[model samples]
Target: MHTTPLTADLVRGALDLERTEHGLLPHRLPARARAQCADPQLHLAESQPSGVRLVFRTRAGTVELDTLPTKRVYVGAPPRPDGVYDLLVDGRPAGSASVTGGNTLTIDMAAGTAEQRPGPVGTVRFTGLPATVKDVEIWLPHNETTELVALRTDAPVEPVPDRGRRVWLHHGSSISHGSDAASPTTTWPALAASLGGVELINLGLGGSALLDPFTARTLRDTPADLISVKLGINLVNTDLMRLRAFGPAVHGFLDTVREGRPDTPLLVVSPILCPIHEDTPGPCAPDFGALSSGRLRFRATGDPAERAHGKLTLGVIRDELARIARQRAAEDPHLYYLDGRDLYGEADSAELPLPDDLHPDAATHRRIGERFAALAFAPGGPFADRAV
Candidate 1:
């Protein structure tokens, strides 16, 4: 077996790769953004690498990756399923594996404390490849903080050549971060990118997609042919801003992106049908009653009447986002609006409710991806591939 040092050249979707004692740690946010962030949530979310993957080409019939993953667990909540590593051979789903044990981060939400316990590195192995030189992608766990330890293959490996697909850069909340999706490649953004025939750079920071200036700057600097921002959920749940501030903040984020990607197709997506937060305001809280039964659920504690005073809600955000997009599109033709409910609306929610009252399940993720691909990448759509 030949072991090769993993480098940034072999990685896609990450903005930076930090050298660690174990190996390279992929970061979705650049150093400038990381330096500007003071929120521990942002730090953790960015490092989780929602859309990051290792891309290479080899004729090896066997491949192995060693990784140390930091899995998060709530204090009294039921244990989470292990993080999954998905393998794609020549852009098709090949196989999936899960490591046994690794580092754990336990959080006591009530006590507002967290503790980390380190463990050994785990290995994910694939024994039967086609033994033909083909592009391969090993997508890391979307919701776990992973440290690449080593990569070994029976044959020499090299970086995969770019397939010349248009890159789609998307930013959203935990839903886009693949919170409950089956695996990395099955995330809504990933599935959408695949169906749309584009490369992906996902900045879906779980619970951290607040309209932070640094995040907007990071998007401003990133290169892409298409760009999208799924807004509203985190802001409403975090109670980070009032309606008065959301308009300008959204505009400022787009302004920053336009500074670098002036002509790139930009789509602004409002929050999907999160029924709990649809009419009610938030500062969403976990239902401890449900947690007692090992079910994690969220409920909006803020009153619906609070909208008169400018407290943000899903309904309010959707209206404002649509208005902003429409007003701006007159000057910026490339700018577009996608009412997120159109992807997962009241009808869809009735059929496939959010298991946790916030995130879509794996099946719902696929549904949303199919909806998004049809809407955004279809002929004459905002992000349509003209070359196709």
Candidate 2:
């Protein structure tokens, strides 16, 4: 039902993939040599005095992960060689382990956390995952820089089987990155994936969905049966570029994704409503005093008063996205548009206020997740029964 692309790029990573009669198999790179051409790493930074923190979602079932020794280590003070790591999984006190210098460890079901025991890079194994691991969350000890060098999962990810459900690939900003959400499983994207009952490849980089061409190329090369791109908010919040460049960038981004997934159900989503960007673009800054006092507050230099002077408004972004979608749909019927406001807007906020005026709170995540499932995964909508 799906057509393979003419060609594919070999991604750089130290991951090995194998397919057999049962399912896809994953193996860590062998010692003394990298399994993937490039390193598989997740970088987390702690600018403030507090230690750095790392959190991610993983299934709770039989799925497992091997955490390689974190290199490029970061700490404010002279490195503490034998610091205790207080690890929390899914908000629960899973376990605590002594972090020794120059060793990797593995955390799993039966064995909570074990040092790699002086073999190659010590491995930290995460096992005893939930059977229905909708998401995985990890909270690292505070005040130190943490770099996740490697993560390998048992995803049964053999090449697409002849008779398996399709995978949904999603790209977005912080919202998609599980910001302000209680846990990884609670992120709207994760929730949507669970309800849709599809494999997920989430490329939601917090504060980094800038419609970069390299990112577009990443999407273009990645295989998918369905794809959705959430845009606008990050561009406006950061004021990364003016309206002049945003439009063309959207066009180019979609164009790249289509290179490999020509007929895939591609949906472009504009920003959900934000008061700061309602009438003008924002370089939003919260009151530092309020922040110190534990009170959340945000202010915009480009308020409604400055709208006449030229600010980025949510309406402006929404309209531009619609324009882009219409322009492309003329040539590609598979392209679709979903106004993000339809998911959350001033109206929803009126009922359930956001924790901080910008990010949606926990309740809102559930609400939006349900709404998205209804629209994107309904029995027979435009996306339903479609193929890549």
Candidate 3:
């Protein structure tokens, strides 16, 4: 087969790109923003490219992609499943694939050290596509850091022209990063983007959605028709800040974003229901008993009484977010608030419990995606007609 190489110019949705010795590494955060953060967790999450994808027009019957996926391994924890790559043809699901033989980043949480082991690249090939020319989208793995080594197709490919849809830029933690979701496209944010008919630039960095100034600056600089920032959960889980700092941090984050997009419709979403952290603070620790049984679960390690001393909890964060949104809305009509509980509340939790006691399962991702579309993007909703 005469193969044609697909380069970075043919890819869409990645915020930034870095050329590595092996190939092109797509980054969800721009270089300026990434340069400001030295946190290892943020470094890993932002480079994973959760919503970034390669979209093009092709008539090729066969497509092949070679990637160097950096898979994470926790020394004492159960191994994670391979991240999935989803292929969409003409806006419909066509097939899926997973890569193997990539580098490994092994972390010993107890020892607090991480080691990298280099490995060979792997290829994912799809054959037997329809002969007619059509749009093709290969969604990168949401959970793994993938370095695109090469792309080859039997026929030449061209970057898909902009569809003129509104760009929805969203930032949040792992739940928004597709944690435990079945595939890249099925993540709540992805599903919501599809249903809402918008282009998604997801900045849902897993375990890394602290309201950092750099992140807010990135948002301020990015162009988007609609935007949202889901806050609180990661902060609580890491116990990164106290109540005193959180309010100002949230304000500063929003203030920075507004500086660039003063009139854009911006929605602030609070964290969804997490029973373990509802009243109690966190430092969420793993449930070893569950882990021993090959199940992953988490329990809040902080005492509820600590809230009196300004330790933050999910409930407290929710109140502050609502208060901030309301106070700011008085001057900014484009700014709106959507309680996270509206998407997934205590009532929904009883029926569809979070398997990990932190992130929602696949079913819940669909539910939340559907509810978000209805509440935020439906007619008269904050984002309604904005994408159109």
The ten-residue window of minimal lDDT in model 2 covers 5-14
lDDT of 2 at 267: 89
Model 2: lDDT equals 0.56
Q: Which parts of model 2 have CA positions greater than 4 angstroms off? A: 1-163, 303-310, 386-388
TM-score of 2: 0.63
Q: Write the residue-wise lDDT of candidate 3 on 198-226 in tens digits.
A: 99999999999999999999999999999
| 158-200: candidate 1 lDDT, tens digit per residue | 9977788899999999999999999999999999999999999
Which one wins by lDDT: 2 or 3?
A: 3
What's the lDDT for residue 193 in model 3?
A: 95
In model 1, where do residues sit more than 4 Å from their true spots?
A: none
**What range of 10 consecutive residues in model 3 has the weakest lDDT sum?**
1-10
* Residue-by-residue lDDT tens digits, candidate 2, 1-388: 1111111111111123334232222222222222212312212211110111233443434322222233222111122233334444444545444333433333221232333333223334445656544433333222222223334555522121122667677777767655556544556776676677665556665555678776677677766788999987777776677677778888888888888889889989888777767776777656455555555556555666544544556788889899989999999988989989889977897997766677887688788877787888887654575454
Q: Against the true structure, what is each candidate's TM-score?
A: 0.99, 0.63, 0.97
**Model 2 residue 92 distance off true place after TM-score fit, in angstroms:** 18
